[model samples]
Target: MMVSYVLVMVIIIKGYGKRIGEYIDEECRREIEKKWERWEEKKRREEEEGVREEMELWREESRRRIGEMKERMEEGIRRRIREKIREKKEEIEKIEGRLELEEEEIGEIELEEEGIEEKLRI
Candidate 1:
């Protein structure tokens, strides 16, 4: 309201009031245009910053997932190695059991032969 009163006073100054008022109007329009341009530039920069931050977050997430996958793969490999080792151990135990049985049978046959030999001598 104060600005409007001041403009009214300037417009009723003299016969040159119209020209002066037009000049002031032109200056005000230029200032308003400059302000709008600055505001738009600020908004554009903020949007660009937001997009950059989002992209960085996405990249970090991707790296994290990749790390997790790599760890899982390594663990799987280790588990497979352990399983193979267990199978080899079982196979060795079975071979040892068979050998023991064979040795006992051989000893029994030797004792029977000795007894038969003593009976022939008598």
Candidate 2:
């Protein structure tokens, strides 16, 4: 009977030990999962910050390029306008010269007509 009691007590002790071990393992798993979640959150935040920084840099670069393009375009337009004005001034000068020549020819024809009339009246 003592031997039987000893065997039963040993079995009960082993069972209790297994239960304790299972509980410890469960607690360790929970802790590991919590640590993994924290690490993931940290990595995600870092990635988001990096992306935002990159986007800001790109935006600044784009703005700078656009400003340069606008300046170049304005310069080109100004040059074209200057060239057109020069051409128009030259055209006006040519027309004025032709008009002067025409007025001189008409004056000579009128003087000849008056001379012819005076000779006919005599």
Candidate 3:
């Protein structure tokens, strides 16, 4: 009789232990799934933020390069304009000098013509 009672108790204990083990396994699986979901969500958010930061950095770099290019272009234009102005001034001076020489030649020719006309009249 004692042996029978012990055997029945052992069976009941093993059945209860199996049930508890299954329940614990299910609870642990649910917890792991929840943790995995949270981790995935966190990773996704981090990736999104990292992408945004990269885009912002690219935009900033692009803007900086563009600004530098614009400044360089403006400087080049200014230098070209200055060179043109200098060239124009040099050309005007050359023209003025030629006109002065032409005027002097015309005055000498007029004097020679007047002398020849006076000799003919004599």
Q: What would the TM-scores of all predictions be?
A: 0.61, 0.73, 0.81
lDDT of 1 by residue, 1-122 (tens): 99999888776886677788999999999999999999999999999999999999999999999999999999999999999999999999999999889888888888888889989899
Q: How does each model score on lDDT?
A: 0.93, 0.95, 0.97
Q: Candidate 3: worst 10 consecutive residues by lDDT?
A: 12-21
Q: Give the deviation of candidate 1 from the true structure as CA RMSD.
A: 7.0
Scored by Cα lDDT, where does model 1 land?
0.93
Model 3: CA > 4 A from native: 1-9
lDDT of 1 at 115: 87
Candidate 3 overall lDDT versus native: 0.97
Error of 3 at 5 (Å): 9.9
Top-TM-score candidate index: 3
lDDT digits (tens) for residues 1-122 of candidate 3: 99999999999989898998899999999999999999999999999999999999999999999999999999999999999999999999999999999999899888989999999999
Which is the winner by lDDT between candidate 1 and candidate 3?
3
lDDT (C-alpha) at residue 84 in model 2: 100
Stretches of model 2 off by over 4 angstroms after superposition: 1-13, 110-122
